[model samples]
Target: MKMALSIALLVVMTSSAGAQYLGNYSANPYAPNSTGNAYGAGSPYNPNSVNNPYGRYGSTHSNSSANNPYAMDAPKLYDSQGNYRGRLSSNPYDPDSISNPYGRYGSRFSPDSVNNPFGAGNPYVPDSPTNPYGQGFSIQGADDD
Candidate 1:
């Protein structure tokens, strides 16, 4: 009985740890690892998908949308080691978005911007999502939840 309990505990712990990172695929449509199918993460039909223009997280009018420049809360990027990087937004007008070419964290000339080939955007950087040839990083949801 003790051995069985220990095995169960180990399984639970391992699953919990795995949940913290996005896998190659996930059941949660909001997860970055989800497929882009109709009910998947990047699906335009998925109500919770960031690709859904009318969804809460994707609507241009929504306060939490990545398309909203004034959005106070956007999905965050993190290194494989779980270090907070910056907001993962496509809004070029958003000051905190990596897509903003003039923003401090988004500028191609900035060391922190992913557009900087020699910096965080380097494809050789193990923690960079732009590093398609490397291990890559994680895209975590907003902490405000």
Candidate 2:
């Protein structure tokens, strides 16, 4: 029984670690009309809603806010296959933000950055939002509706 229990614990630990490396498997916060989008604003009073200026995730003064430069919990972006892309932030100072031109995932020269015309930003890529001629693009993260 002891041996079985140990094996089970090991399995659980391994799975949890793997999931973390792959990124949080949550709904796409960047999706059009999503709570994170300015256009798809959620309840104006919901703490996590970007529409709430006083909310933790919405307040510019909060460390976890998407608008905060020091935010550590900015909404993450994931591809349709659940691949971890990066943080979906407009803060130019956040190292993980896709808007940071100097960051790995945000650099226009970086292959993973959406600003890279030859890479993730390519208009020909179906998943690229820059692809105006293609179907709508999608990503994952943020508070549930």
Candidate 2, residue 113: Cα displacement in angstroms equals 0.5
Residue-by-residue lDDT tens digits, candidate 2, 112-137: 88788897777776666465433222
* Local distance difference test scores for all models: 0.62, 0.60
Worst 10 residues of 2 by lDDT: 19-28
Task: Report the lDDT tens digits of candidate 1 across residue range 17-110.
Answer: 5422222112233434553334445677766566679977678888766667777666666666766556667777778687889986589998
Candidate 1: worst 10 consecutive residues by lDDT? 19-28
Segments in model 2 whose C-alpha atoms lie over 4 Å from true places: 1-47, 131-145
Tell me the lDDT of candidate 1.
0.62
> RMSD to native for every prediction?
6.7, 6.2
Which residue ranges in model 1 land beyond 4 Å of their true spot? Answer: 1-40, 91-95, 133-136, 143-145
Clashing residue pairs for model 2: 27-141, 28-140, 28-141, 29-141
TM-score of 2: 0.57
